[model samples]
Target: MTSPGVAPGLLRVQGLCSGYGRSQVLFGVDLHIGEGEILGVLGRNGMGKTTLVRSIMGLLRPTGGTVELGGRAIVGLAPHRVARQGIAVVPEGRQVFANLSVLEHLTAFARGGHGTAHAWTIDRLLHLFPRLAERRSNLGGQLSGGEQQMLAIARALATNPRLLILDEATEGLAPLVREEVWHALSTLRQAGMSMLVIDKYVRRLIGLADRHVILEKGEVAWTGSSAQLEADRSLWSRHLGL
Candidate 1:
């Protein structure tokens, strides 16, 4: 089902319930991201932010609810199947292959003929994150945390996904590096790339995302435009513990 009063979006989650080993996390959560829209998911720790991303990525089987991409259900599909369906996730912790070089990472996951003329080629991704270009021959394990994060995002983009989900993309990094990452994201936004961004940097998220979804205890406590969220500080304190 579509979100009330909103058109069907590129990705939609309705009454989504999920958990690990019977410990339920998400509870009837609902949110959507329109084409070329950026949706920010915000919450305090243990509030099921990652759980929601995992459920969408098909990493964890949801106990109930529906997950749809481009209006098609993908509830029980495998993780790879979900990726093939045009959803790519830059998981928390920037899980780059330790043994792979920067060039290898992009080439291995590149999805040819699936993207527009602006498709993320290795050179394009390197252009987006120039440090990665300089470190093309460097192994993933040798890069700094910020560089690793950049690579993780680049690898996901290589798939040319219709929707990109970034779980805590700027969790731990220097201020400069975080700014770099945010700049790349803003550039992607300008290019009309749809994204679901999960980051603790609410201020930055407000500047980047078109809309926001605040998750509290596995449920969507509030959702609104960036302007609305920016004007409501109580929502920030109550739901986000900011």
Candidate 2:
């Protein structure tokens, strides 16, 4: 299942179906994230965008289909096993360890066992998130909302994953912080980090992501390049009601 492109994809998902309790959220969702490309998952709230991420991360078990990371079957595996396999996710709501200090959070989740490169070391993470460095000794709860979001991304990156999935990467942040986050994402893309970005910024997603997949009513209603999505504004207005 090789995706043809400049720098082919590292993550591939097909026929993904998942749910909470008995209520299914994702129904036959399909998507891919190229080796160095940024893929955006677009949809209105409660449209199953976050559920797709949870399924891929193994935080939620898929009722059907496969989630392959670097071309290996990972469906139904434990969350830690999935993370160990080089698939890391910054879940929605920036779930940082409230009891840990900023630096502690980094150290606790440091890269190990995988023998991956140190591209996301504490120093580099600090550089990427200067505010976190400023509050390195502060408890995670002591940081602002935007700062906590930064820490969440930094914590995920510190694992040095092959495919990074960010659920609502820039949600609820101030405009300036959102800009900073977009800047960091752009830099990561340039550095050849494959990412699955979920956000509501249509205009910016068009610029940053190489491809786009829109989830509607728990299904993949649209899939194409960013240009295709931008060209068809009606698609968004019709499916996402944006």
Q: What do the candidate models score in CA lDDT, each in turn?
A: 0.91, 0.86
Clashes of each: 0, 1
Candidate 1 wrongly placed segments (more than 4 Å): 1-7, 113-115
Tens-digit lDDT track for model 1 on 117-166? 67888899999999999999999999999999999999999999999999
Off by over 4 Å in 2: 1-4, 112-118
The Cα RMSD in angstroms, rounded to one decimal, for candidate 2 relative to the true structure is 1.9
RMSD of each: 2.1, 1.9
lDDT per residue as tens, model 2, 8-97: 547788899999999999888887776777888898999998888888888899999898887889997899999999988988899998
